[model samples]
Target: MIKNFSKLALAAGVSAAIALPASALAEIRIGIAGPQTGPVAQYGDMQFSGARMAIERINAEGGVNGEMLEAVEVDDVCDPKQAVTVANRLVNEGVSFVVGHLCSSSTQPASDIYEDEGILMITPASTSPEITARGYELVFRTIGLDSMQGPVAANHLISLEPKRVAVIHDKQQYGEGIATSVRDTLEEADVNVVMFEGITAGDKDFSSLVTKLKQADVDYVYYGGYHPELGLILRQARQADLDATFMGPEGVGNKDINTIAGDAAEGLLVTLPPSFDEKEVNQALVKAFEEKGEDPSGPFVLTSYTAVQLIAEGIEQAGSTDPFEVAEALREGSFETPIGMVSYDEKGDMESFEFVVYEWHADGSKTAVN
Candidate 1:
């Protein structure tokens, strides 16, 4: 009877242990939100892939404060309304930190939710100046603002000394803002901007715009938009035999443009964040990504990786996952990341960031301009 009782007790103990919820393990959950399924899903793919790689590396080496890190991802489709829904879901999931909402349109709306909930959001790719300028204590970005990129693009075009410059935008907040900045900067430089226009983002036909460019005898065209429209315009321009130089902001730097514009994507000039893949320090990471059948050279990959590193480092420094504590720690210290050492200003903007110009090659690759 005594042996049977002991056996029964042991069985009960094992049963209780098996029945315990997995949540009892204790994990630090971080959210990664972006357009997982949309026109810009490529950007989200890069962001999430880099984020997952960081989380895996950190957890493998022993997580922050002994709590394992877990990633929670949501698809916002890069739409403003969907972004709000995604933000609320992350809040409900008890995620104190977020690194996402890649598009400016989505990030702007989602930021409001994060600010009100006291959740810290650090975007890797949203570049609208208004994001940092909005006076939100919990908002930050790893990438430089379009305000800095616009002038660089303008100067590049001016250096070419085109006969007549034409500027176009996709009519979105990011597209329009950068386009206006480039236009204004060019005009201030006493350059002739013969044509300024806006087009819908999803429009497939740019034949009319190509006609306008030809009619204006434009030698250089600066477009402030994503790669899709820019690619189409370049293809159509080549079909029309326009023979004009095309330049764009960072939004047009994606490799997808190679497929969209084919050989016409060659000779395309773009202003983008400094390519981190070229750095010797990132070679191991690049290899790790390639081993996983992923490309680490995407525009947002390094920045997104840096975003995750920032959050993990901040959590370690603060010794807590509390969003407020992490935010304070992030602002108080500089972090060395895959991109380089980064320090933030009070406004949550990087103290110093660089944008470089690159020329696209025919083989779907880009080389940084000296």
Candidate 2:
């Protein structure tokens, strides 16, 4: 009787041990929200692609703490109202970490929801300084702020020695904020800005604006807006036989501009972060993207990938999935990623990110200006 009892006890212990790891292997969901179906869908698509690839690689390598990382994508369409809804949905779905809401307009509103719910968000593209200036401990961004890039744009235009300059913005938060920064910097540098104006974002006709620029005899036009409007302005400016050099922020760096403006995009200038496509460490990632029939050279691609890597590394460092603990861990350490070493300041902005000028060519390619 004693021997039979011992055998049964040992068998029960073995059964319990066998079930432990299986229960611990449950997947953890990470949210990736952006404009998956709108004017800037290409940016969202790149964010999704980077997150998907990161999750796949991390899972294949045993994941975070032996549990798989799964991405739950939500399309906010870069709209503020839609972003709030997406944030609520992510909270309801029990996502503890999020990467996105690419535009500052959407990110600003969505961040409030995440903070109240204790969800940690890291944006890869939104550059407005206000995004971090809100003092939310749960908010962070992988890109530099407009305050940094604005001066760069101003200085570049000043170096061009244009007799007069014209500055235009779409009047949205991100567009207007960067535009205002550039205008202020130019004025401080004593550069003559002949015209500073605002235009509706979705307007298809910029002939009137081009006519104004022509009348001002502006040799350089600095546009603080997205690719669609910039593309149209470039085309119309060319059609009107204007020889002014067009410059814009990273918002205008998308390849879609090439399609929109055709050969007129050849001499367009843009300010953007250093190119990640030429990095030796990113060759594999670039090849992987090509194999999947996607371009890996967009402005936000590597930054999005770095955001995912930072979250996973934070989880590993914290030894828990609790959002508060992970946030603390991220603040305490630096991460090495495809974009190089990334460290955040107290405000959750990258410490070493820099913006450079690039000139677009007719073959749908951009080269950095020395």
Candidate 3:
């Protein structure tokens, strides 16, 4: 569990902007839980930036019900065990809601604790369907699930009509789960799936994997994992002179991939949340993020902002601070958020969410292709 004294230590290496407003009249405390130090902490930066911005803006607008909101942040380091520890820390601090547990593996365990403890949680990035499939009233997210993302990628692949496709994963919950989804969808669509394999998450060398890909004579590769591994795979594959188009889910859609893979990152296809910052209606909000030196274009930023907005609105519509009432209000109402109109199904997932496919470039920018 992260203690008060270690907050600075956690922030030292992370690039996320932190804005914590302290009010004497703090009534509702929202716990921000995610990685402050980990391999995937770059994504955590988006989560923290969006939630902190929302908290700041909401408090500036006189808060909810005349009670100012407070923030209690915890670092889980994107590790499931650390997530459980931080979730318990949030529980002990008596936070009414949480905005994180970013990685799906971490979110699952932390959500189990939150559900039992009656803490309302809205993960802005964790997309494993299992998190919400258990029918937990408290678990919700601002992002679409692997079930939604996989088929989108596969359908796009089908349209391209590749001769042979290879699917790879990191063997973790999020990676393997989405990889399986893509494989299943491809098989159903009568596409030739040459291989489906798992790779170690942190492995640096992919020479052997490159050989396997070449041996399979695959023309396209679909990776289900975060950017780090995929970035390395792209770099090594480029060195080995393997010719194949690479596509991945949003998990591998970070700008850091450009840094890792260098020029090899160009032409990588990724399915991600729509560019909310690019929407005209959100220009002012995008400027607000820019003014504060935050990058709003990252996939999780606006979704996380919407998570905080939903919680605040849910509380107001319910006319109570009880998390149960807030949860019910969230499921029953439609919200106009930066992402778009959000209305939850009975399982607490958005009834309609859009995932756009983008063509990534080596300059750390992407253009929508589908």
Give the candidate number with the greatest lDDT.
3
Model 2 residue 309 distance off true place after TM-score fit, in angstroms = 0.6
TM-score of 3: 0.93
Per-residue lDDT for 194-264 in model 2, tens only? 99999999899999999999989999999998999999999999999998999999999978999999999
- In model 1, what is the error at residue 61, expressed in angstroms? 0.6
Model 3 CA RMSD to the hidden true structure, in angstroms: 7.9
- Ordered list by TM-score, greatest first: 1, 3, 2
Clash tally, candidates in order: 0, 0, 0
Q: Model 1, 1-370: lDDT tens per residue?
A: 9999999999999888877545545788889999899888888899999999999988988988788889999999988999999999999988889998799989999999999999999999998999889789999899988888999999888888877999999999899989999999999998999989999999999998899899999899999989999999999999999979999988888888998999999999999888798799999999989999998888799899899889999989998888889899999999888888899999999988889999998788888887
TM-score of model number 1: 0.93
User: Could you tell me every candidate's TM-score relative to the true structure?
Assistant: 0.93, 0.93, 0.93
Relative to the true structure, candidate 2 has a C-alpha RMSD (angstroms) of 5.7
Residue pairs whose backbone atoms clash in candidate 3: none
**C-alpha local distance difference test of each model:** 0.91, 0.91, 0.93
